[model samples]
Target: MQVKHGFIGFGNLAKAVYQGLKEEEEIEFAYFARSRKEADIPYYGRMEDLTAFADVIWLMVKPQDLSAVLEQLKTCDRAGKTIVSPAAGRNIAFIERYLGKEQLVVRIMPNLAMAYRKSVTAFATNQPENENATEIFGLLGKLGKAVQLEENGFDLFTAVFGSGPAFILSFIQIFKEKMQEFNLPGPLLDELLLELTQGTTLYFAQNQKKHSIEELIRNITSKGGTTQAGLDYFRTHEIGKHFEGILDAARKRSEEMSKNGD
Candidate 1:
Protein backbone atom coordinates (compact mmCIF):
# COMPACT_ATOMS: atom_id res chain seq x y z
CA MET A 1 0.00 0.00 0.00
CA GLN A 2 1.31 3.46 -0.88
CA VAL A 3 1.35 5.70 2.18
CA LYS A 4 0.77 9.38 1.55
CA HIS A 5 2.89 11.61 3.79
CA GLY A 6 1.97 15.26 4.06
CA PHE A 7 4.14 17.98 5.54
CA ILE A 8 2.55 21.03 7.20
CA GLY A 9 5.57 23.29 6.77
CA PHE A 10 8.01 22.66 3.93
CA GLY A 11 11.19 24.09 5.40
CA ASN A 12 14.63 22.52 5.81
CA LEU A 13 13.49 19.75 8.12
CA ALA A 14 10.57 18.92 5.88
CA LYS A 15 12.88 18.95 2.89
CA ALA A 16 15.29 16.65 4.66
CA VAL A 17 12.54 14.21 5.62
CA TYR A 18 11.20 14.16 2.09
CA GLN A 19 14.65 13.73 0.62
CA GLY A 20 15.39 10.92 3.02
CA LEU A 21 12.20 9.00 2.29
CA LYS A 22 11.60 9.91 -1.34
CA GLU A 23 13.15 6.73 -2.67
CA GLU A 24 10.74 4.45 -0.79
CA GLU A 25 8.43 2.72 -3.23
CA GLU A 26 5.53 2.61 -0.81
CA ILE A 27 5.64 6.26 0.30
CA GLU A 28 4.37 9.36 -1.51
CA PHE A 29 4.97 12.98 -0.50
CA ALA A 30 3.05 16.26 -0.51
CA TYR A 31 3.04 19.53 1.41
CA PHE A 32 0.66 22.19 2.73
CA ALA A 33 2.29 25.54 3.37
CA ARG A 34 1.51 29.24 3.21
CA SER A 35 3.31 29.47 -0.13
CA ARG A 36 4.30 26.82 -2.62
CA LYS A 37 7.83 25.56 -2.16
CA GLU A 38 10.34 24.83 -4.92
CA ALA A 39 9.75 21.09 -4.50
CA ASP A 40 7.93 19.15 -7.20
CA ILE A 41 5.57 17.30 -4.87
CA PRO A 42 1.84 17.90 -4.79
CA TYR A 43 0.91 21.04 -2.88
CA TYR A 44 -2.26 21.74 -0.92
CA GLY A 45 -3.06 25.26 0.18
CA ARG A 46 -5.48 24.07 2.87
CA MET A 47 -4.65 22.02 5.96
CA GLU A 48 -7.94 20.14 5.87
CA ASP A 49 -7.34 19.14 2.27
CA LEU A 50 -3.86 17.87 3.06
CA THR A 51 -4.99 15.99 6.14
CA ALA A 52 -7.74 14.30 4.17
CA PHE A 53 -5.23 13.14 1.58
CA ALA A 54 -2.40 12.00 3.80
CA ASP A 55 -2.18 8.81 5.88
CA VAL A 56 0.76 10.32 7.80
CA ILE A 57 0.98 14.02 8.62
CA TRP A 58 4.30 15.56 9.56
CA LEU A 59 4.17 18.64 11.80
CA MET A 60 7.24 20.25 10.26
CA VAL A 61 6.88 23.83 11.48
CA LYS A 62 9.22 25.52 13.93
CA PRO A 63 8.38 25.28 17.66
CA GLN A 64 7.13 28.89 17.86
CA ASP A 65 4.86 28.35 14.85
CA LEU A 66 3.69 24.91 16.01
CA SER A 67 0.78 26.29 18.04
CA ALA A 68 -0.70 28.12 15.08
CA VAL A 69 -0.39 25.03 12.91
CA LEU A 70 -1.89 22.78 15.59
CA GLU A 71 -4.78 25.19 16.01
CA GLN A 72 -5.55 24.71 12.36
CA LEU A 73 -4.88 20.97 12.57
CA LYS A 74 -7.37 20.54 15.40
CA THR A 75 -10.15 21.40 12.99
CA CYS A 76 -9.19 18.71 10.47
CA ASP A 77 -10.63 15.20 10.26
CA ARG A 78 -7.57 13.32 11.53
CA ALA A 79 -9.09 9.82 11.77
CA GLY A 80 -6.51 7.03 11.30
CA LYS A 81 -3.76 9.51 10.44
CA THR A 82 -0.45 9.20 12.25
CA ILE A 83 0.85 12.58 13.43
CA VAL A 84 4.65 12.84 13.45
CA SER A 85 6.49 15.79 14.91
CA PRO A 86 10.18 16.75 15.06
CA ALA A 87 9.65 20.09 16.78
CA ALA A 88 12.19 20.68 19.55
CA GLY A 89 10.87 20.99 23.14
CA ARG A 90 7.30 19.99 22.16
CA ASN A 91 6.15 16.62 23.47
CA ILE A 92 3.42 14.21 22.40
CA ALA A 93 1.28 15.45 25.31
CA PHE A 94 1.54 18.97 23.91
CA ILE A 95 0.26 17.70 20.55
CA GLU A 96 -2.43 15.57 22.21
CA ARG A 97 -3.68 18.69 23.95
CA TYR A 98 -5.00 19.86 20.60
CA LEU A 99 -5.54 16.56 18.77
CA GLY A 100 -6.87 14.54 21.75
CA LYS A 101 -5.80 11.48 23.79
CA GLU A 102 -6.66 8.71 21.33
CA GLN A 103 -4.70 10.26 18.48
CA LEU A 104 -1.44 8.51 17.68
CA VAL A 105 1.24 11.17 17.88
CA VAL A 106 4.90 10.28 17.39
CA ARG A 107 7.40 12.77 18.74
CA ILE A 108 10.86 12.62 17.15
CA MET A 109 14.17 14.40 17.61
CA PRO A 110 16.28 14.10 14.47
CA ASN A 111 19.01 16.13 12.79
CA LEU A 112 19.43 17.21 9.15
CA ALA A 113 21.45 14.03 8.73
CA MET A 114 18.04 12.57 7.92
CA ALA A 115 18.72 13.64 4.35
CA TYR A 116 21.58 11.16 4.27
CA ARG A 117 19.57 8.45 6.07
CA LYS A 118 22.09 8.63 8.94
CA SER A 119 20.24 10.54 11.66
CA VAL A 120 20.37 9.18 15.22
CA THR A 121 16.67 9.67 15.97
CA ALA A 122 14.57 9.43 19.12
CA PHE A 123 10.95 8.22 18.99
CA ALA A 124 8.13 8.39 21.52
CA THR A 125 4.44 7.93 20.94
CA ASN A 126 1.12 8.50 22.71
CA GLN A 127 -0.02 5.05 21.58
CA PRO A 128 2.77 2.53 21.96
CA GLU A 129 1.11 -0.64 20.73
CA ASN A 130 -0.81 0.81 17.81
CA GLU A 131 0.28 -0.97 14.65
CA ASN A 132 0.49 2.27 12.69
CA ALA A 133 2.59 3.86 15.40
CA THR A 134 4.90 0.86 15.34
CA GLU A 135 5.18 1.22 11.59
CA ILE A 136 6.26 4.83 12.05
CA PHE A 137 8.91 3.68 14.51
CA GLY A 138 10.05 1.06 12.01
CA LEU A 139 10.42 3.74 9.36
CA LEU A 140 12.55 5.76 11.75
CA GLY A 141 14.78 2.73 12.25
CA LYS A 142 15.30 2.60 8.48
CA LEU A 143 16.49 6.20 8.58
CA GLY A 144 18.97 5.65 11.42
CA LYS A 145 19.38 4.47 14.99
CA ALA A 146 15.87 5.06 16.37
CA VAL A 147 15.41 4.46 20.07
CA GLN A 148 12.13 4.36 21.97
CA LEU A 149 12.69 6.70 24.89
CA GLU A 150 10.61 8.30 27.63
CA GLU A 151 9.41 11.87 27.12
CA ASN A 152 11.51 13.14 30.03
CA GLY A 153 14.67 12.03 28.22
CA PHE A 154 13.92 14.13 25.12
CA ASP A 155 15.71 17.27 26.30
CA LEU A 156 19.06 15.51 26.60
CA PHE A 157 18.44 13.59 23.35
CA THR A 158 17.75 16.86 21.57
CA ALA A 159 20.97 18.30 22.90
CA VAL A 160 23.01 15.26 21.95
CA PHE A 161 21.42 14.02 18.71
CA GLY A 162 19.34 16.80 17.19
CA SER A 163 22.03 19.37 17.89
CA GLY A 164 25.01 16.98 17.68
CA PRO A 165 25.85 17.30 13.97
CA ALA A 166 26.45 21.01 14.22
CA PHE A 167 28.59 20.56 17.34
CA ILE A 168 30.75 17.92 15.62
CA LEU A 169 31.11 20.18 12.58
CA SER A 170 32.06 23.09 14.81
CA PHE A 171 34.86 20.98 16.30
CA ILE A 172 35.96 20.22 12.75
CA GLN A 173 35.82 23.95 12.02
CA ILE A 174 38.43 24.43 14.74
CA PHE A 175 40.74 22.10 12.85
CA LYS A 176 39.99 23.90 9.59
CA GLU A 177 40.84 27.25 11.14
CA LYS A 178 44.10 25.98 12.63
CA MET A 179 45.09 24.56 9.23
CA GLN A 180 45.13 28.11 7.82
CA GLU A 181 48.83 28.00 8.72
CA PHE A 182 49.30 25.44 5.90
CA ASN A 183 48.42 28.04 3.20
CA LEU A 184 46.36 25.37 1.37
CA PRO A 185 43.15 26.23 -0.47
CA GLY A 186 40.04 26.46 1.73
CA PRO A 187 38.28 23.60 -0.13
CA LEU A 188 41.38 21.43 0.22
CA LEU A 189 41.40 22.03 3.95
CA ASP A 190 37.73 20.97 4.15
CA GLU A 191 38.44 17.85 2.07
CA LEU A 192 41.34 16.90 4.34
CA LEU A 193 39.20 17.47 7.43
CA LEU A 194 36.43 15.31 5.94
CA GLU A 195 38.91 12.48 5.35
CA LEU A 196 40.21 12.81 8.91
CA THR A 197 36.72 12.58 10.40
CA GLN A 198 35.68 9.69 8.13
CA GLY A 199 38.87 7.77 8.89
CA THR A 200 38.42 8.36 12.61
CA THR A 201 34.80 7.21 12.42
CA LEU A 202 35.79 4.09 10.46
CA TYR A 203 38.46 3.25 13.05
CA PHE A 204 35.95 3.61 15.86
CA ALA A 205 33.37 1.53 14.01
CA GLN A 206 35.89 -1.27 13.46
CA ASN A 207 36.99 -1.70 17.09
CA GLN A 208 34.22 -0.03 19.13
CA LYS A 209 32.42 -3.29 20.03
CA LYS A 210 35.41 -4.79 21.80
CA HIS A 211 37.28 -1.66 23.03
CA SER A 212 36.31 1.27 25.20
CA ILE A 213 36.62 4.81 23.83
CA GLU A 214 39.46 5.64 26.26
CA GLU A 215 41.35 2.58 25.06
CA LEU A 216 40.95 3.73 21.46
CA ILE A 217 42.37 7.12 22.38
CA ARG A 218 45.23 5.48 24.25
CA ASN A 219 45.98 3.37 21.19
CA ILE A 220 46.60 6.55 19.18
CA THR A 221 48.52 8.32 21.93
CA SER A 222 52.21 7.50 22.21
CA LYS A 223 54.24 8.47 25.30
CA GLY A 224 54.94 12.23 24.83
CA GLY A 225 53.60 12.23 21.27
CA THR A 226 51.85 15.10 19.48
CA THR A 227 48.35 13.68 20.21
CA GLN A 228 49.25 13.24 23.91
CA ALA A 229 50.62 16.79 24.03
CA GLY A 230 47.36 18.09 22.59
CA LEU A 231 45.40 15.86 24.95
CA ASP A 232 47.36 17.28 27.89
CA TYR A 233 46.56 20.84 26.80
CA PHE A 234 42.90 19.86 26.26
CA ARG A 235 42.65 18.48 29.78
CA THR A 236 44.62 21.29 31.42
CA HIS A 237 42.39 23.95 29.83
CA GLU A 238 39.18 21.96 30.64
CA ILE A 239 38.01 21.94 27.01
CA GLY A 240 35.89 18.83 27.58
CA LYS A 241 34.11 20.55 30.46
CA HIS A 242 33.42 23.57 28.26
CA PHE A 243 32.08 21.36 25.45
CA GLU A 244 29.81 19.59 27.96
CA GLY A 245 28.59 23.02 29.05
CA ILE A 246 27.36 23.59 25.50
CA LEU A 247 25.18 20.44 25.70
CA ASP A 248 23.84 21.42 29.13
CA ALA A 249 22.93 24.88 27.85
CA ALA A 250 21.05 23.39 24.93
CA ARG A 251 19.19 20.97 27.24
CA LYS A 252 18.23 23.85 29.53
CA ARG A 253 16.85 25.83 26.61
CA SER A 254 14.88 22.78 25.41
CA GLU A 255 13.33 22.36 28.85
CA GLU A 256 12.40 26.04 28.97
CA MET A 257 10.76 25.82 25.59
CA SER A 258 8.74 22.75 26.60
CA LYS A 259 7.11 24.66 29.46
CA ASN A 260 6.75 28.16 28.04
CA GLY A 261 5.43 27.15 24.64
CA ASP A 262 2.28 25.97 26.28
Candidate 2:
Protein backbone atom coordinates (compact mmCIF):
# COMPACT_ATOMS: atom_id res chain seq x y z
CA MET A 1 0.00 0.00 0.00
CA GLN A 2 1.22 3.49 -0.69
CA VAL A 3 2.02 5.61 2.34
CA LYS A 4 0.02 8.77 2.84
CA HIS A 5 2.23 11.86 2.95
CA GLY A 6 1.26 15.26 4.27
CA PHE A 7 2.91 18.65 4.38
CA ILE A 8 2.31 21.48 6.85
CA GLY A 9 3.60 24.25 4.60
CA PHE A 10 3.62 24.20 0.81
CA GLY A 11 6.73 26.13 -0.11
CA ASN A 12 9.25 25.60 -2.93
CA LEU A 13 10.99 22.53 -1.48
CA ALA A 14 7.66 21.01 -0.55
CA LYS A 15 6.38 21.63 -4.05
CA ALA A 16 9.51 20.03 -5.47
CA VAL A 17 8.96 16.81 -3.58
CA TYR A 18 5.27 16.90 -4.29
CA GLN A 19 5.93 17.12 -7.98
CA GLY A 20 8.49 14.36 -7.75
CA LEU A 21 6.21 11.91 -5.95
CA LYS A 22 2.80 12.94 -7.19
CA GLU A 23 2.83 10.44 -10.05
CA GLU A 24 4.75 7.72 -8.26
CA GLU A 25 3.28 4.23 -8.26
CA GLU A 26 3.80 3.85 -4.50
CA ILE A 27 3.17 7.31 -3.00
CA GLU A 28 0.18 9.56 -2.41
CA PHE A 29 -0.29 12.85 -0.52
CA ALA A 30 -2.51 15.61 0.78
CA TYR A 31 -1.18 18.76 2.33
CA PHE A 32 -2.03 21.68 4.60
CA ALA A 33 -1.46 25.27 3.57
CA ARG A 34 -2.57 28.62 4.96
CA SER A 35 -4.56 29.05 1.79
CA ARG A 36 -5.59 26.37 -0.71
CA LYS A 37 -3.57 28.02 -3.46
CA GLU A 38 -0.39 27.67 -1.46
CA ALA A 39 -0.46 23.91 -1.88
CA ASP A 40 0.45 22.19 -5.11
CA ILE A 41 -1.59 19.14 -4.15
CA PRO A 42 -5.06 18.75 -2.75
CA TYR A 43 -5.05 20.57 0.61
CA TYR A 44 -7.19 20.82 3.67
CA GLY A 45 -7.90 24.07 5.47
CA ARG A 46 -7.83 22.31 8.84
CA MET A 47 -4.87 20.55 10.41
CA GLU A 48 -7.19 17.93 11.88
CA ASP A 49 -8.16 16.75 8.41
CA LEU A 50 -4.56 16.59 7.28
CA THR A 51 -3.44 14.89 10.47
CA ALA A 52 -6.05 12.18 10.10
CA PHE A 53 -4.98 11.42 6.52
CA ALA A 54 -1.22 11.41 6.92
CA ASP A 55 1.05 8.61 8.10
CA VAL A 56 4.15 10.80 7.59
CA ILE A 57 4.07 14.56 7.68
CA TRP A 58 6.66 16.98 6.35
CA LEU A 59 6.87 20.21 8.33
CA MET A 60 8.05 22.96 5.95
CA VAL A 61 7.19 26.12 7.82
CA LYS A 62 9.71 28.76 8.98
CA PRO A 63 11.29 28.57 12.45
CA GLN A 64 9.02 31.34 13.74
CA ASP A 65 6.02 29.71 12.11
CA LEU A 66 6.73 26.44 13.90
CA SER A 67 5.40 27.54 17.25
CA ALA A 68 1.89 28.35 16.07
CA VAL A 69 1.75 25.26 13.90
CA LEU A 70 2.87 23.19 16.86
CA GLU A 71 0.13 24.66 19.00
CA GLN A 72 -2.42 23.69 16.41
CA LEU A 73 -0.87 20.25 15.87
CA LYS A 74 -1.01 19.56 19.62
CA THR A 75 -4.77 19.54 19.38
CA CYS A 76 -4.68 16.65 16.87
CA ASP A 77 -3.72 13.00 17.23
CA ARG A 78 -0.05 12.40 16.43
CA ALA A 79 0.74 9.08 18.05
CA GLY A 80 2.65 6.64 15.79
CA LYS A 81 2.87 9.20 13.03
CA THR A 82 6.24 10.43 11.72
CA ILE A 83 6.92 14.17 11.48
CA VAL A 84 9.77 15.16 9.19
CA SER A 85 11.08 18.70 9.40
CA PRO A 86 13.16 20.15 6.56
CA ALA A 87 13.44 23.61 8.01
CA ALA A 88 16.91 24.99 8.66
CA GLY A 89 18.04 25.70 12.26
CA ARG A 90 15.20 23.66 13.91
CA ASN A 91 16.09 20.32 15.48
CA ILE A 92 14.32 17.18 16.66
CA ALA A 93 14.38 18.23 20.31
CA PHE A 94 12.60 21.43 19.42
CA ILE A 95 9.92 19.42 17.61
CA GLU A 96 9.52 17.05 20.53
CA ARG A 97 9.25 19.95 22.95
CA TYR A 98 6.57 21.64 20.90
CA LEU A 99 4.65 18.67 19.49
CA GLY A 100 5.08 16.01 22.22
CA LYS A 101 7.51 13.34 23.36
CA GLU A 102 5.73 10.63 21.36
CA GLN A 103 6.27 12.33 18.02
CA LEU A 104 8.57 10.42 15.68
CA VAL A 105 10.54 13.31 14.22
CA VAL A 106 13.39 13.61 11.74
CA ARG A 107 15.34 16.62 10.55
CA ILE A 108 16.75 17.08 7.05
CA MET A 109 18.69 19.67 5.09
CA PRO A 110 17.85 18.98 1.44
CA ASN A 111 19.17 21.50 -1.07
CA LEU A 112 17.04 23.09 -3.79
CA ALA A 113 18.38 20.56 -6.27
CA MET A 114 15.51 18.35 -5.16
CA ALA A 115 13.48 20.36 -7.68
CA TYR A 116 15.22 18.33 -10.37
CA ARG A 117 14.95 15.06 -8.39
CA LYS A 118 18.69 15.22 -7.78
CA SER A 119 19.55 16.19 -4.21
CA VAL A 120 22.18 15.30 -1.65
CA THR A 121 20.03 15.52 1.48
CA ALA A 122 21.45 15.09 4.98
CA PHE A 123 19.06 13.33 7.36
CA ALA A 124 19.12 12.82 11.14
CA THR A 125 16.50 11.28 13.34
CA ASN A 126 16.07 12.07 17.03
CA GLN A 127 17.36 8.64 18.10
CA PRO A 128 20.39 7.35 16.28
CA GLU A 129 19.74 3.70 17.11
CA ASN A 130 16.01 3.60 16.60
CA GLU A 131 14.78 0.56 14.65
CA ASN A 132 12.50 2.61 12.42
CA ALA A 133 15.35 4.80 11.23
CA THR A 134 16.19 2.33 8.50
CA GLU A 135 12.67 2.40 7.11
CA ILE A 136 12.71 6.20 7.15
CA PHE A 137 16.06 6.25 5.39
CA GLY A 138 14.89 3.81 2.72
CA LEU A 139 11.81 5.86 1.95
CA LEU A 140 13.85 9.03 1.46
CA GLY A 141 16.48 7.16 -0.54
CA LYS A 142 14.11 7.14 -3.52
CA LEU A 143 14.27 10.92 -3.67
CA GLY A 144 18.07 11.14 -3.61
CA LYS A 145 21.07 10.38 -1.41
CA ALA A 146 19.79 9.96 2.15
CA VAL A 147 22.87 9.85 4.31
CA GLN A 148 22.16 9.40 8.01
CA LEU A 149 24.04 11.89 10.11
CA GLU A 150 24.32 12.46 13.85
CA GLU A 151 21.90 15.12 15.02
CA ASN A 152 24.72 17.41 16.12
CA GLY A 153 26.29 17.17 12.68
CA PHE A 154 23.16 18.71 11.13
CA ASP A 155 24.24 22.26 12.01
CA LEU A 156 27.58 21.86 10.29
CA PHE A 157 25.91 20.34 7.21
CA THR A 158 23.49 23.28 7.10
CA ALA A 159 26.34 25.77 7.22
CA VAL A 160 28.28 24.08 4.44
CA PHE A 161 26.48 21.72 2.04
CA GLY A 162 22.99 23.11 2.52
CA SER A 163 24.13 26.58 1.52
CA GLY A 164 26.76 25.37 -0.97
CA PRO A 165 24.79 25.84 -4.19
CA ALA A 166 24.23 29.53 -3.49
CA PHE A 167 27.92 30.04 -2.76
CA ILE A 168 28.91 28.31 -6.03
CA LEU A 169 26.36 30.35 -7.98
CA SER A 170 27.74 33.56 -6.50
CA PHE A 171 31.21 32.64 -7.73
CA ILE A 172 29.84 31.67 -11.15
CA GLN A 173 28.11 35.06 -11.48
CA ILE A 174 31.39 36.83 -10.75
CA PHE A 175 33.07 34.74 -13.43
CA LYS A 176 30.30 35.65 -15.87
CA GLU A 177 30.74 39.37 -15.20
CA LYS A 178 34.50 39.08 -15.61
CA MET A 179 33.98 37.59 -19.06
CA GLN A 180 31.80 40.56 -20.02
CA GLU A 181 34.31 43.05 -18.58
CA PHE A 182 37.01 41.52 -20.85
CA ASN A 183 34.76 42.30 -23.88
CA LEU A 184 34.35 38.60 -24.71
CA PRO A 185 31.43 38.25 -27.15
CA GLY A 186 28.27 37.33 -25.22
CA PRO A 187 27.37 34.03 -26.98
CA LEU A 188 30.95 32.76 -27.03
CA LEU A 189 31.48 33.74 -23.38
CA ASP A 190 28.25 31.96 -22.43
CA GLU A 191 29.28 28.80 -24.24
CA LEU A 192 32.76 28.82 -22.69
CA LEU A 193 31.44 29.27 -19.17
CA LEU A 194 28.77 26.60 -19.62
CA GLU A 195 31.22 24.03 -20.99
CA LEU A 196 33.85 25.07 -18.45
CA THR A 197 31.54 24.27 -15.55
CA GLN A 198 29.52 21.38 -16.96
CA GLY A 199 32.49 19.55 -18.45
CA THR A 200 34.56 19.98 -15.30
CA THR A 201 31.71 18.61 -13.20
CA LEU A 202 31.19 15.67 -15.56
CA TYR A 203 34.91 14.88 -15.58
CA PHE A 204 35.05 14.72 -11.79
CA ALA A 205 31.92 12.57 -11.58
CA GLN A 206 33.23 10.08 -14.11
CA ASN A 207 36.76 9.76 -12.72
CA GLN A 208 36.22 9.65 -8.92
CA LYS A 209 39.97 8.98 -8.99
CA LYS A 210 42.39 8.79 -6.09
CA HIS A 211 43.39 12.44 -5.81
CA SER A 212 41.76 15.06 -3.59
CA ILE A 213 40.01 17.96 -5.37
CA GLU A 214 42.87 20.33 -4.50
CA GLU A 215 45.30 17.84 -6.03
CA LEU A 216 43.16 17.81 -9.17
CA ILE A 217 43.42 21.61 -9.34
CA ARG A 218 47.22 21.31 -8.98
CA ASN A 219 47.31 18.88 -11.87
CA ILE A 220 45.50 21.30 -14.21
CA THR A 221 47.51 24.39 -13.25
CA SER A 222 50.86 24.75 -15.09
CA LYS A 223 53.60 27.27 -14.40
CA GLY A 224 52.61 30.80 -15.63
CA GLY A 225 49.53 29.43 -17.39
CA THR A 226 46.26 31.38 -17.90
CA THR A 227 44.65 29.41 -15.07
CA GLN A 228 47.57 30.35 -12.82
CA ALA A 229 47.16 33.98 -13.84
CA GLY A 230 43.51 33.96 -12.79
CA LEU A 231 44.35 32.11 -9.57
CA ASP A 232 46.99 34.73 -8.77
CA TYR A 233 44.47 37.53 -9.30
CA PHE A 234 42.00 35.93 -6.86
CA ARG A 235 44.76 35.21 -4.36
CA THR A 236 45.96 38.81 -4.50
CA HIS A 237 42.44 40.02 -3.72
CA GLU A 238 42.10 37.65 -0.69
CA ILE A 239 39.22 35.73 -2.32
CA GLY A 240 39.67 32.84 0.10
CA LYS A 241 39.33 35.20 3.06
CA HIS A 242 36.19 36.72 1.53
CA PHE A 243 34.63 33.25 1.14
CA GLU A 244 35.47 32.34 4.72
CA GLY A 245 33.77 35.50 5.95
CA ILE A 246 30.69 34.79 3.84
CA LEU A 247 30.28 31.17 5.09
CA ASP A 248 30.98 32.23 8.68
CA ALA A 249 28.18 34.75 8.54
CA ALA A 250 25.82 32.10 7.10
CA ARG A 251 26.79 29.65 9.85
CA LYS A 252 26.29 32.23 12.61
CA ARG A 253 22.85 33.17 11.33
CA SER A 254 21.89 29.46 11.26
CA GLU A 255 22.99 29.10 14.89
CA GLU A 256 20.93 32.09 15.93
CA MET A 257 17.81 30.82 14.18
CA SER A 258 18.05 27.35 15.74
CA LYS A 259 17.79 28.99 19.15
CA ASN A 260 14.49 30.82 18.60
CA GLY A 261 16.28 32.44 15.69
CA ASP A 262 14.63 34.05 12.70
For every candidate in turn, the CA RMSD to the true structure comes to 0.9, 2.4
* 1-262 per-residue lDDT for model 1 (tens digits): 9999999999999999888899999999999999998998999999999999999999999999998999999999998899999999999888999999988899999999889899999999988989999999999888878999999999999999999999999999999999999899999999999999999999999999999999999999999999999999999999999999999999999999998983
lDDT (0 to 1) per candidate: 0.94, 0.81
Model 2 Cα lDDT, one tens digit per residue, 1-262:
7788898988877888887667777677888988876554678889999999998888878778987898889889987888888888988888888787667788888877776667778888875566555666776676777788877677777877789888988888788997777897888887888898999898787666876887777778999999899889889999899898888888888888887656
User: Which segments of candidate 1 are over 4 A away from where they belong?
Assistant: none
Each candidate structure's count of clashing pairs: 0, 1
> What are the models' TM-scores?
0.98, 0.89
